[model samples]
Target: MRVEGLKLTPVSSAGIEQNASEVASGSKNFGEFLTEALGEVNQLQNDSAKASFDLAAGKLQDVSQVTIAAEKANIAIQLTMQVRNKMIDAYQEVMRMQV
Candidate 1:
């Protein structure tokens, strides 16, 4: 079963490096980038919740869309958690350094 308008693309390391460089070069700060990422995750979660509600209410016909939205939200949340963990680890390591 193929879902229309659903396209999966591989992420490139070069693109990630470019984005990091842009953020580091004063175009955008780390805090703003983090905020935007969190906002996107929140939006994906909201979309998944709405899709679930629609499906439960018999208003949605495509189950694949709902599944996709849920998976997107889940992956975003997992990635956010990983990043948060890494940041905490780095902070603790810095604190362990001698002055």
Candidate 2:
């Protein structure tokens, strides 16, 4: 599955350092960060579904890949749900705040 016109590259040490600095300086909001993180998780789930289908059809050879992909998708979904719950709790707390 090739993404057209997308340049994929490993995160260099300097890039990681820059991102860390921005986060530490509060330059990136939590909502933006979580949105990007959840997008990655959604991509993982799609990939996992494809891999599992291929494995079931005997097109994929490695069972471990299927298993790992499924597990990653599961964990990502669980984490996203937890984050959503926390956000709902926070909203309720704010609504009940004595202003």
Give the number of the best model, judged by lDDT.
1
What TM-score, to 2 decimals, does candidate 1 have?
A: 0.76
Candidate 2 deviant stretches above 4 angstroms: 1-16, 24-27
lDDT of 2 by residue, 1-99 (tens): 877897899767998899889989998898898889989999999999999999989999999999999999999999999989999999999999998
- Enumerate residue pairs that collide in model 2: none
Q: Estimate each model's TM-score.
A: 0.76, 0.74
lDDT (Cα) of model 2:
0.93
Residue 82, model 1, lDDT: 100
| Model 2 vs. true fold: TM | 0.74
Instruction: List candidate 1 stretches off by more than 4 Å.
Output: 1-21
In angstroms, give how far residue 64 of model 2 lies from its true place: 1.6
After the best TM-score superposition of candidate 1, give how far the Cα of residue 66 lies from its true spot, in angstroms: 0.9
